[model samples]
Target: MKTELLEFENKHKLLEPTSTERVATLEAISEYTENFLGNIDTLPAFVNNVSEKAPFIQSINFEEQNTLNEVLKNIRLYIDTPGINPASGGHLGYIPGGGLFYGAVGDYLACITNRYAGVRFASPGAVLLEETVLNWMANLFGYSKNYGGTLTSGGSIANLTAIATARDAINLKAKDYHKAVIYTTQYAHHCLQKSIRILGMDDVQWREIECNNLYQMNVEELEKAINKDLNNGFLPWLLVASAGTTDVGAIDPLQQLSEISKKYNLWFHVDAAYGGFFILTNKGKQLLKGIEQADSIVADPHKGLFIPYGLGAVLIKNKKLLHKTHQYLANYMQDASTEKVDLSPADLSPELSRHFRALRLWLPLKIHGEKPFENYLNEKMQLATYCYQQLSNLPDVEVFNKPELSVFAFRFLHKELPLDKYNEKIQKAVMNDGRVFISSTRLNNCYVLRIAILSFRTHLSTIETALTVLDKSKKIAEDELYQELRNN
Candidate 1:
C-alpha cells in the first residue's frame, strides 16, 4: 500500500511547482499586466465581441494541460479583450475605478502569501491589517472605538452584510418580517432592495420616498411617510440614504434624515459606496454632513479610492450588534475563540473564508497617503462639473440637474425622432464608437445618458476626448436614424 501511494504521489508532483517554474510564471504575468497597463488608455472602454454566432464556449475543460504562454494568450484574447474594459479611463458610464498599480502589487503579494485573514489565530498580522483599514474608514466617518466592521467583496456584499446585521439587531423573527418597513429614495442602489428580499423581508413595507427635481429624496415626504407608517401600526425600522446616488450622484439630505431616524428610533444606513471617500476633501465634508451619525454606513474603496473593483467596507457604530449578528459558534472554532484575539473578521462578517483584501487597499493608502486621494476625488468632482457644463452648452442637449458629487445625467434632444429611440440609438452609437463608453437610464419615464466620473486616470484630456466623441457619435446617430426613417 505504501509503495502504491508513493507512485500516485510521484504522478501528481506537478501540482507543486519548483522555484524555476514559479519565477517563469510570475515573470510572464508581470510582463502581460505591465503591457496591459501601458496600453490601457488606447483600449476601448466598452467592446462587444460576442455576437450570436460566436459566443464563449460554455465548457471549461482541464482535460488537457496548457503551457503558461498559451494560457496567457488565451486569457488576453477571450477574457480581457471582450466586454466592458473596466480598467480603462474612458469608462465614464458606470462608477469608474481605475485599478491602481500599487493595488496590483499588493494583490500579488497577498496571493503569493495566501494569508488566512479571516481569523486572528491563523494570521494575526493579516487580521490586524484588515481591522486597521476598517478603523481608518471608521475614523473618516466619525465612528467610535466601540464600533466594528468587515471588509467585503464589493458594495453588493457589503450592503448585504450590513442589512443582515440590522435585521438581526432588530431581533425580529420571520413572522415580523412582513410587517416591518424600510424607507429609501429611488436612487438607492438596487442591491439594498435585493438584500432586503434576500433576508426574507420581501414583504416589508418598502417605501420609495418622493424626490425633488434634483432626484434627492424630499425630507418632508420622508417624514410624512414615516409618521404615516407609525400611525398605521407598521414597524419603521430602517431608513436608508445615499451619500452619492448611482444615476445622478444626488446626495439625499443626510442631516435631516438622521434627525428623523433619531425621532423615530430607526437604523440609518448610508450607502456611500461611490462617494464616501470624498469626505477627505473640505467640500465633501460639508456635503456629507451628518454621515457620522449613521447607525451604519457602506463604502467601497474600489469606487471612491480607485483601488480596483473588489473592496467594500461597512462601518457600524454599535460593535456588539455587529458581532451578535454575524458571530458563529462551533467546537471547531474553539481554537479561534478568546476575548482578546478578536473580535476579528470571522466574528463580524458573513464570510468564513476571506481573501486578503485589506492588503490591496492598505498598500496604496500607505504609499500615497490620504492627500492624493482627496485631490483625486476633488478632481473627479470637477471633471463631472466640467462634463455637465460642456454637455449643457451643446445645442439641443438637456442637463438633468447640477451634479451633487461626481456624476450627472444628460441626453440629446432630437426634434425629428422619438426621444427614447433617438437616445437609445445614440447610446448604441457611442458604445460602438469604442473611444469612450457611456450609459443611459430612464429618469421620470425619459431616457437620459448618465456619466459617473471617478476614475483616477480621468483627467482634463480624457474629458475633452469624451466630449468630442459624444459630439461625433450624436451626429453619426442622427444621420443613421435619419437615413433609416427616409428609407422607411
Candidate 2:
C-alpha cells in the first residue's frame, strides 16, 4: 500500500513544477500578454466573425497534461479572435473600463497567495489592506472612520447587499413586505429592482418616478408619489437614485431627492456604480452634490476607476447595521468569530469566502496615484462633449440632452423611413465595421445610439477613429436600407 501511494504521488508530480519549468511558464505567459498589449491600439473594438467549430476545442483533453504553448495557441484562436475586445481603447460601447496592467499584476499576486480575505482571523494583513482601501472610499463619500463597506464582485452584488442591509435595518419582516413602498426613477439600473426581488420583497410597492427633460429623476414626481403613498397608508421606506444612469448618463436631482427621503424617514441609497469615481474631479463634485447624504451607496471601482471589471463597493454610514445584517455563526467558523481589530469582511457581505479584490484596486491607485485617475475621468467628460459636438455638426444627426457625465444618446434623422429601422441598420453597420464600438438604447420610444466614453485608454484619437467609422458606416447603412426598401 505504501509503494502504491508513492507511485500515485509520483504520477502527479508535474502539477508541482520544478523551478526552471515555473520560469518557462511565466515567460510564456508574459510574452503572450506583452504581444497583446503591444498591438491593442490596432485591434478592432468588435469582431463579427465567430467560429465555434474548431479542432482545438476537441483536441484538448483536461485529463492529460498540456504544454503552455498549446494552451496559449488555443487562447489566441478561440478566445481572443472573436467578440468584443474589451481591452481595446476603441470599446466605446456600454461603459468600458480599461484593464490597467498594474491591476492585472495585482490580480496575479492575489491568485498566487490565495489568502482567505473573507475574515481577519484567517489573514490579518490581507484584511487590514482591504480595510484601508474601503476606508479610503468611505472618506471620499464623506463617511467617517466609523463608516464601513464591503468590496463586492460588482455593482449588482453591492446593490443586493445594500438592499438586504436596508431591509434588516428597517426591521422589515415578511408580513411588512406587502405594505412597503420603494421609489426609483424609471431609468434606474435594473439591478436595484432585481435586488428587491431577490431579497424576497417583490410584494412591496414600487414607484417608477417620472424623469425630467434631461432624463433626471423628477423630484416633484418623487415627492408627490411619496405623499400619495403615505395618504394611501403604505409605508415608504427606501428611495434609490442614480448618479449616472446607464442609458443616458443622467444624474438624478440627488440633493432634492435626499431631502425628500429625510423628510419621510426613508433610507436613501445611491447607485453610483458608474459615476461615483467621478467625484474625484472638480466638476464631478458639483454634479454629484448631496451624495454624502445617502444612507447607503454602491460604487464600482471597475466602471469609473479603470480597474478590471470585478470590484464593486457598498458603503453604509451605519457600520453596525451593515455588520449585523450579514454576520452569521457556525461551529466551523468559530475560529473567525473574534471581535478584535477591524470587522471581518465576512461579517459585512453575503460572501463567506471571497478573493482579495482590494489588491487589484489598490495597486493601480498606489502606482498611478489619484491625479492620473482624476485626469482620466475629467477627460472622459471632455470626450463626451466633443463627440456630442461633432455629432450635432453632422447633417443627419440629432443630439439628445447635453451629457451630464461621460455618456449621451444621439441618432441619425431619417426623414422618410421608420426611425428605429434606419437606426438599427446604422447600429449594425457600426458594429460590423469593427473599428470603434458604440451601443444603442430606446429613449422616449426611439432607438438612439449611445456613446459611453469611460475607458481610460480612450483618448482624442479613439474618438477621431469613431467619427471616421461612424461616417463610413452611416453611408453603408443608408445604401443598404434604401436598397432593401426599393427591392421590397
- Model 2, span 145-254: residue lDDT tens: 77769999999999999999998998999998988998997888999989988888899998999898999888888888988998989999999999999998899988
lDDT of 1 by residue, 1-488 (tens): 99999999998998989999999998999999988988988988888775443223334666777788877786787788777888988888878866998998899899989999988989989999998999899999988999889999899999998888888888978888777999998889999989987887788889999999988889899889988988998999999999999998888999999999999999999999988989999999999999999999999999999998789999888999989888788888888886543587989998888899999999999999989999998998899899889889888999897888989988899878888878888888888888778888889889999888888888888899888888888888888888988999
TM-score for candidate 1, residues paired by index: 0.97
Residue 363's lDDT in candidate 1: 98
Query: Where does model 2 exceed 4 Å of error?
Result: 58-61
Q: What shift in Å separates residue 467 of candidate 1 from its native position after superposition?
A: 0.9
Number of backbone collisions per candidate, in order?
A: 0, 0
Q: Kindly give the stretch of ten consecutive residues in candidate 2 with the minimal lDDT sum.
A: 57-66
Per-model RMSD to reference = 1.6, 1.4
Worst 10 residues of 1 by lDDT: 50-59
